[model samples]
Target: MQKQREVGNRVFVTGIGLISALGNNVAENHSSLAAGKDGITKAVHFESLYTETLPFGEVKLSNDELKALLHLENEFGYTRTCLLAVKAFEEAVNDSGLSAEELSSFDTALISASTVGGMCLTDQLYDDANMKFEGSEYLEAYGCAAHTMRLIEKYKINGFTDTINTACSSSANAIMMGARLIKAGRAKRVIVGGVDALAKYTVNGFNALKILSEFPCKPFDENRDGLNLGEAGAYLVLESEEVSVGKRKYAEIAGFGNSNDAHHPSAMSDDAVGAIISMKTAIESAGIDATKIDYINTHGTGTPNNDRVELFGISQIFEKVPPFSSTKSYTGHTLGASGAVEAIFSILSIQYSEIYPSLHIETNMEGFDAAPITEFQSDVSVNYVLSNSFGFGGNCTSLVIGRVN
Candidate 1:
């Protein structure tokens, strides 16, 4: 049985911004997906020991190039992570046609998420902490909340603000919180999303776990071995219906659900308890039947554990699972930015009436009748999309985004 609750003021996604290995903005990423272009390759801009040995979804731009693109060439103390967030956030704010006064209004909120904040500059942080240098510009930019503070200060935002770091599910929770704030009448609008940049800290950490893929990740493949690390930043402008009237509404944030099974620190339980609850609760929260889900953007990390457990969870929730695929196959596992990155992909499905294929799948995983869509599909009646993001520590979140009508 599923639980139900009264629906409040509807939340609509009015604007979206994204920067990833695929491209620097929403249109570029969309074009890459439609053309079947793969962005995973050997790292060029990011410096790492695995740069030549392993594949990654590395953003093509360098830190200096990004700063120049954002017209912050004269600025200092901006890390790679902060630069990515600013690019996306600026795009989102501009896409929504928000005025400077509106951004600084009290009815607005900024809810961002990140797992690898300024920690991307781990070496600089260490040097600063040890006082090896007289004073590092990045001294105050080392926390998980550093990017959030940067945005708040840059935009002169004076409303509610928060930064979430719930592992891979960070941005999904950020989106959920933004919706809750609007529904509760605490804010009329919110900028919600996440950002993460490749760093030695994360690369070394995942490598230590022995889950770094040597080649491009193949989500839901029977012979899948591991996942590829990636870097990206994405944001969405969500507003209450009353506030978004006459605006270009991309999709309605119908419902969302979150759960923690606490089964493992980095892996889900064999039974997929947390994912099951998250999906079911999302469906119930949408006040729709499980069958109403037209598509699902799975948390398919292409790892041995995640692909299998996530499929099992889906099998339990829907009688006949809908068309599902993992966008991570294109962007690699983006960690914190994944949830919002894929959420925008889901919205594209609803808006364009198409489905993006999951690349590099040669053999389907056994024990499941459902297989991922391997080719670009169009002219489909896509109305509702379920975007799932399951993080380490069994933190699972699902968002149901649907057409406004």
Candidate 2:
């Protein structure tokens, strides 16, 4: 057993919100995950040459529908990415019972993450850049920080606000940053997560990489071929122990670790150096033995390289690995949104004492000595969970979430 060490002020997850192919809100997503439902389907809202061919974990709502739902129908310059973030952000603040005054207080902060951002308007951006359009409403919304800026303005946030873009690890880093702020006494509460919407840019890019699966992804399977791109937005409200005293906490943000291997642009090292370091550091910071982890929400992108290297990293950490599964099989790979998506899934495991299976897996990868949980399990002991998010350029992050006792 590893020696326990105190980190800092404890951070608790007071609320969560999400919108993905699985569902529109936290409750719906929880129901889908509990039932082992698969959300990947052929793209309906996104227009692309591969729309009918490659499957994606796309939210069911269209741009107009989202606008109507958000009551921003007449508004301009709100991209799909911004709309999604607003939806999830609203839910998170409501769930946390944050008031307008509290939200605008100097003790509150907003840290968001996104990769697609307004780039989801790839065609509009290109047309506007080429001066094909006289005036474009989306010209100011083309950057990755566009969504963050929108949130800051919408909520009248006055405290520290920042945006992170570490590829797939973006949201995980956002969560880590939020926790750090609370621990450092910079803020009493932090709203953190990420959002990304499907665009022709990412679709064409992944297709070019030859990593788009025609069918639903089968993560960690020996026969796993590639990943199905996904789009989603999710957020979690983290509050300091003092502020969260009267609130309902789903879990504790026990610890988090991040590292960059810089091994490859989009591939982790074969030795899993980044993964090993992040996971180990998270466990150590949490002051828990690696064996204390009851479940792991792996960053299983259904790619051959990711699955193999992640398993290698796990093997190097624990003498006996914990039971783990990939919820990406449910939501696909939501890119920047994946880290927060899986973090919420990890909290669900702790809250419900249940394990959601990695769906569509056929054969376990040979020589791994570890296979993902293949069926829905209930009444399981889920005290601690490790959620992983590894992204392009070797960015890897892990968060240790523990049950609120």
Report the lDDT of model 1 for residue 162.
96
lDDT of 1 by residue, 224-292 (tens): 999999999999999998999999999999989999999989999999999999998888888888888
lDDT of 1: 0.93
Residue pairs of candidate 2 with colliding backbone atoms: none
lDDT of 2 by residue, 1-405 (tens): 666755578999998999999999999999999888889998889988898788999999999999999999899999999999999999999999999999999999999999888999999999999999696999899999999999999899999999999999999999999999998888999999999999999999999989889889998999999999899999999999989998999999998999999999989999999999999999998889998999999999999999999999998998999998999999989999999999998988999999999999889999978899998999999999999999999999999999988
TM-score, model 2 to reference: 0.99
Give the worst 10-residue stretch by lDDT in candidate 2: 1-10
